[model samples]
Target chain A: MNPIRKVLRAGFELIERPFDRLFGPALNPVAQLGALGFFFFWIVAVSGIYLFIFFDTGIERAYQSVEYISRDQWFHAGVMRSFHRYASDLMVVMVLVHLLREFAYDHYRGVRWFSWFTGLPIIWLLYVSGITGYWLVWDKLAQFVALVSSELLDWLPIFGEPIARNFIATGTLTSRFFSLMVFMHVAVPLFLLFIMWVHILRISRPKVNPPRMLALMSLAALLAVSIWKPALSQGPADLARVPNGIGLDWFYLPLYPLTELWGNGSVWAFLTAFSLMIALMPWLPPLRRARAAEVDLEHCNGCARCAEDCPYEAIKMVRRTDDLPFPTEAEVNPSLCVSCGICVGSCPSSTPFRRTEELKTGIDLPEYSLRQLRERVMDVASGLSGPGRVLVLACEHGGAAGRIGDTVVMPCVAMAPPSLIDFILSRDLADGVVVAGCAESACYNRLGVQWTEQRFAAERDPYLRARVPRERIATVWASALAASKAEAEIVEFAARVAAMPPKRLRSPLPVSSTVPTPKALQTERGTT
Target chain B: MKALRWIGQFVVIAALFAGVAALSDWPRYSQIPKDAGVVMLSFVHGADRKGECRRLTPEEIAKLPPNMRRVQDCPRGRRAVYVELDVDGRSAYRADLPPTGIAGDGPSRVYQRFVLPAGRHDVAVRMRDSARADGFDHESRKSVELMPDQMLVIDYRPENGSFIFR
Candidate 1:
């Protein structure tokens, strides 16, 4: 990672840890930025609709109507107006921070480019909708925004007649002007919502709403602030006079002041270049992607577990093309795949008990096959000499990758299935198996740690068998910079494993006949 | 202890909201000075055609295609418009605007604004839209009183045949 992003990521983690402890990891705002944005969007929309009910679109009445809402209906419409404005401000802050967080995590590259690319237009639409919303108040600030925005548009060569002419005098503006502003304020946000949908189209099970308690708490906070300091317009706009000092919403109108400082043309040029650079950020330096997963038809039983478990939604079930008895088979779209090897973990055929000369899963990464992973684990386990004789399956992106002994790093901790853990403990390969992945709710592959936790708890498919003792299994979630914490966790788990009673050895089975039967396959599928 | 943590989290969230509200409207922006007035010169006017029409000879007309003959031939392009404004005997704004459209056959548009002290001032504007180009075809001068923060607009209309000040 770049040094700047590394520092930023660390800073964010520092701030988030306390919140995680207070609100719990599931409800932390840092993990819920996207969902919180949606909550704010709904607040803005609902309050805007209520404000429009009492708003008049006439040029002369527009300012008076807003004043009435702020003064006459202070308790209801006034609070709603404040909610509309402050919620909008909050949304912008959340979105910008969200963008920075994703950039710092390097989530804008590879297959995740679609979300980042689609976000560029949302930024424009957000500003456009916000600027137009301010214009509807018809106050001094609105007049300034109208004239400056018009002047900015007039800077472009495409306009044959300068739009600034419309704001020259009091008689120049018409009722149609307010109507147009209202239309833009409403229409742009509706289009923005569509783009927001497209932003998460590639990810499976995107969270569109925050947790219930978090939402209620955020609402209460917004309400308290709305009542404490109500939003009031800066005075009515007088076209015959120039607008002097006025309150400015720094979130949306920050660029308006730039137009005056650095002439309109320079501002426009800067905006164009900056937007273009942000739009092409994913490929500013193209990524070198890992090889995608491939399917082995002979091992596949037409089970859709891999398709269901894929975080990228890159896999889908299709009609079986082979003579397999099952009705459907998994098909992988190579372009959308991140080659995280998560499908191998979800596949029922991915078990160390399979005794074939070459162990192949239904869908697996070509670079690091399941057979190689098993062999690597066995080799790492054989060299352990301590009393605990621990084997750690660590995620490459997390803190435990190289911090402890007898470690075998996988692309994601979930890439090692529960059956692999059972295989190790049952064969006396290691005294304990510790699965360490990225920080909670911050999985590099989105759901690697989540599914791994569920599978171990026997709540999800391909669960750990009851025979494997739970005391010998431990899991740790930490970021890449938390190496000391990971080491501490390993130390504690190793001590516990070392103190446990010795396991009863089972009769050794012939290696050539360990393939799963039909009934065993059904059990792996969680259908029996 | 957990309750205390929850209270602390709520206070932090409220503080964040208060911070956003504070910046939402603080540090008031002044777009224009209080004791200054603005004058904006804006107009959209088409210039004269670039080339004059010439009467075709009878022989030339006869050689033309049966349905494609005319008495005169004229070019489609128009001349660029030149405009200059002087405030209190100083050049304030000047532009040589090109005609609109790909064929250069449309109106030339311009909009410029200048800020001056709020007091009595003399304003003059000149525009040239013909091929002659050396001197202005239309000119106007006015002496007007401007109050603090007042706006004065200099506009033009083809039918009015001169500059219009409001």
Candidate 2:
């Protein structure tokens, strides 16, 4: 009995050690960011798989496949489409949040600067992925993306040269190379995983996933949203037509607003400055003497553990042959220091060449005022409508319902987030949200209103089925509604939403199947 | 109300542009609309280039020994086979070599073209016995992978066997 007990104990110790090392390592605020990032990646993968099965690449078959998926097999394909679109936005949001949190926390100095530096490319890739996804629809948006990309590239020196000539060589788009673009759109995410791994390597405690419950709920919500309102593909691109109002994604596309304020070249300059200025933040006015890292001379043991663990490789040891306590004294580089506190945590001997909190004494949130800002945002959302059960949209399309309780909120619906969406939905603040976009890719700013639609496409952008089922959220490309089109739509949409049974807020996670059982399949089909 | 009407007019004009886009996309719909019927249209792609559908130029006849040349088919008729040879003269892409009256996975699909007359007809793919005899075999080879649903055009001199009716 004693021997068996000892063996079981040994097995547990072996298992528990790894878990403890992973979870309870050094102090980490940035680990939460990693967890959220992984959560969104999972959403992206699940949605991509759903999208790929239905994506057709032929010139004639592309739009057709989208139509079949949205309208014909909408019950199943719709859910999958929603998952893909919603998860894409969710992942991007998580990534942005993670980057901002790290920046605010001052985790990008010294040895850790490499991770910070490499992260710029990761953000670029994410936007490109979003752009490619938009183009896959072969709608007006795809046409616009093509036009803009061509125009941008045309100004470069290579167009008449071999490189540009080969690229625009009339027949290549119709050749085997076109197939490669399809393959690449599917494969680029695999490369992004490596970039993320390196990004989180500086931290001792890195979370590769979110809490189990949140993951499952997010997946379920995505699936539910997809089912409620299947994604719709506009007809094939028409170069001749002009569309009215289009949806916009404001996060990455905030540049769109600038375009409205400025023309092409100046806007381009603004974007370039925006990225470069952030990159050049460390070179700003030097930190105050107190804010810079300083050594606690009394605790100095010269063990050099901090130097070993530093991610930016910023610490250097000076050799003094004749000095009393010297042979290997440590010095910290102020220019390279990110103040992430890896050195503070790694020191076995209680000697810190620089203090972590001291370096960040003057730190504050990037936003001007958290409390005042929150109140202002809430006010804006609330103030959009005149009264009860208001529908806030970016466009003025859906006011025809005039059902005493219904109203359209804003000029563009893409500005609202799932959180804002949740606040309104939970309080029964609005009866519904009807986002009618211009034809896909028709936004003048080259902003992805459709991409925004895709991101918030989930049944619960804030939380699945928290207030309304996914079906209540929709993306319709409105030219002008015929004489009575806007009125008919408003009345139609409001009545339909009002008619829906209250949403059941079950944990909005996708149900997974390790084994494909018959019962599981039936339950998956909404039988249970 | 008048200002509102003006804004509404602007929106409608934009919408009209969208409607025109929709209208143009109608015939290109993925699924045949309920109102669709057998419309007269050619399956126009790169059929002629893929098929051996080139006219023999007058200079070529003069270059050829006069005794070997015979009055062949019409100069402007579609041929049965198209051979696309690679730059190095190796066999590359071929079209219209399958047995007539059948369409399946093989060398080529059977011609159901209304433009081509229905019958057992002598056809020329890339090169035939006469073209070989006239030393015009160089024009018959093309290098490409045979794909499903490919279209091509072959040109033959003899108009009798060359008229396409599908």
Per-candidate chain B TM = 0.85, 0.26
For model 2, how does the per-residue alpha-carbon lDDT over A1-528 read when each residue is reduced to its tens digit? 135334543443343333333332121212344575677677677767876788788655776777787778777776666556655665666677566544543434444456666677677677767666766766654544543444344434333311222221123244243366577666677777778787766543345776564355445555554554445665565432221123333333444334434644676677578678657654442223223234444444556745554444556666633345746755677655444333443343321112332211111112221222223333433443422233634332222322222333322333333444443454444546665543232221112243345446542222222344566654444322221444456557767777777655432433223222223433555654
Clashing residue pair totals per candidate (backbone < 3 A): 0, 67
- Global lDDT of each candidate: 0.87, 0.44
Which parts of model 1 are misplaced by more than 4 Å?
A: A499-528, B1-3, B52-74
Instruction: Report the Cα interface RMSD of each model, rounded to 1 decimal.
Output: 1.4, 19.6
Which candidate should be chosen as best, given lDDT against the real structure?
1
**DockQ of each two-chain model:** 0.66, 0.01
What docking grade does candidate 1 earn? medium
The window of 10 residues in a row where model 2 chain A has the poorest summed lDDT is A359-368
Q: Give the winner by TM-score.
A: 1
